[model samples]
Target: MHLSEMTPEVDTHTHTVLSGHAWSTLTENCLAAKRRGMKGLCLTEHAPAIEGGAPSFIPHSQQMLPDTVEGIRVYRGIEANILDHENHLDVPPEYLRLCEWAIASIHSHMFPEKAKKTENTETYLAMLRDPYIDILGHADDPSVPCDFEALAEEASRQGKLLELNNNSTTAHRPGSLPSLKEYILCCKRRRQRVCVASDAHFHAMVGNVRPLMTLLEELDFPPELIVNLTQEGFEGYLRERITRLKNLH
Candidate 1:
């Protein structure tokens, strides 16, 4: 099947107003996702480390939302920040443990040793080892380059997902196309699982993953390697991740 013919069932990365820079509310995001034919959306507000983002209690607070909103599932989750190369995340383990889905990212100005690719790669490689982090958010930013091959291998070994962030590949991170393409190629080479995300900060952008899909179509990336490509597939991955997490504890 052509990549154009299939839509990712879930918008695995998105944000609401709880994430300071975002412009929409949870209700708005869910409605948009549903309108765009998505079966679910991950409510991945930034963790406390973000200057004007959600508090650490976000995970506990997310439980207040219903399992489905505006007729589509809204997975309670957090986009936790990778604090250092020591596998440390800004949000504490207790709260992270409460999240249904979690994304670990290195935001601009927030990551130390920023321009150092070696250190950056080490940081991401370490984050993948965290059981609670389901995906690594937006590693395509050119300012923070890392080893995509290492990341893909690590995520595959751990059965985790790497993100193909639409915003980063398109508008958010300029000069990122080449790097993002490289990242995708590495995932394809390793046959690692990935999640195609809008990384939408607004309601209108929810489930808008066309640009990345176009790239995948061009590369002939395997749809099976993308966890959220179908609702059943996405749910199955979540179940498997849950079982794996359970084994860890």
Candidate 2:
């Protein structure tokens, strides 16, 4: 089926006002996702490590939200900052355990110093080693360069997903398409999981991943690799992850 005629069942990455920079409310985002025909929405606020990002209490209080919002399943998560090569995350392990899913990304503002490609790659490798990290968000952004091939292979081995962020590839992040295309190719080649995200800051942009969908279609990328296409697959990942966390206790 052509993606132009389809929308992802779940948008695994997004932000609300709690992120300190985004424009929407969690309720508004959920409404928009439902209106756009999405079965699920992951509200992944930026972790505290980010400059002016979410407060530590935000992730800790995720359970206060209803399981379903505006008739759509709500998955609460965090876009955690990868602090350094040591794999330090902005959120503590206790808070990380509270999240249903987690997407780790390197925000330059969070780092004390500039990191080279080798350091960036090593940091991500370390982050993926943490089982709480379920997806890698916007590795396509050139500002935080890393070895996509290495990341894709590691994500595959760890059963983590690499995101194809719509905002990063389209307008917000410039000069990212070439690298994003390469990352997608690497994921396709390694048979790794991929999540298409709008990374929407506003309510209207939720579930708006048409650009990445078109690109995936152009590449003839297999649908099976795209986890957002099926609601069962998307939500199943969270359920399985939560279960794994419980088992670990």
Candidate 3:
């Protein structure tokens, strides 16, 4: 399905007021997404990685977020932090099990230097092999020096989705364009599918994949390869991925 036909895009990664650093409420974000014509959105709160992280403040309050909002489906998700060289999650597996979907990513605390980048990449690759991890968030962000080609190939082999994050381009980690380009090229070469994430910290940013979406188009990316273009397509892809991961474990 074409993205415009899908309309108001399905954003799989977003942050709400519950995240201390974020500025908008969940309802506000839902309303904004509606205005932007998004079919659905996921509220992926931060999963605490280190001693201090945004997720540490909210705790596991999935029950606090309604199942639906303003006629749009809102999924409860968590961007779990990779806290160790082993690529272990900071949030307990029990808490993680409660989420409809989970995005695992490396943060500064876990990836400190260049050598750590290689280690973190291997660790993330291992997590991608995990049945429960639905998406691998922002693999190209410069803050973590993973080899994009290797990561993309691994994701493709495992059938895990990679993210082209808008926020990674804007703030969370700046000056990431080159690395992002490399990652995109690698995905194209491997025929790997990708998901675009807003990584929004406020309501206004909820459905804004324009910047990265444009980049994808510029690179001549085939829209059919993006798993989230349609609800059924995404679910099927995710289920198959989960099964694949489960077999690995």
**Alpha carbon lDDT of each predicted model:** 0.85, 0.83, 0.74
TM-score of each: 0.95, 0.94, 0.87
Model 3 over residues 127-205: C-alpha lDDT tens digits? Answer: 8776678778887877677777777777777678888887755656788888888888888888888888788888888
Best by TM-score: 1
Model 3 stretches astray by more than 4 angstroms = 1-8, 50-60, 113-115, 241-249
**Of the candidates numbered 2 and 3, which has the greater TM-score value?**
2
Tell me the lDDT of candidate 3.
0.74
lDDT of 1 by residue, 1-249 (tens): 689666788989888988898999989988887787889998888888888887555566678888999899988888888887676888887787888888999987887677989989988888888787888999878889888888888888888889999986665788889988888898888898889999899999898888889899999898888889888888898897689778987
TM-score: which is higher, 1 or 2? 1
In terms of lDDT, model 2 sits at 0.83
Q: What residue pairs are clashing in model 2? A: none
Q: Alpha carbon lDDT of residue 118, candidate 3?
A: 71
TM-score between model 2 and native = 0.94
- Model 1 stretches with alpha carbons more than 4 Å out: none
Model 1 TM-score, 2 decimals: 0.95
For residues 107-174, write the lDDT of model 2, one tens digit per residue: 76566554488888878877777878888888877778889888987887877788899976666887
- The Cα error of candidate 2 at residue 107, in Å, is 1.3
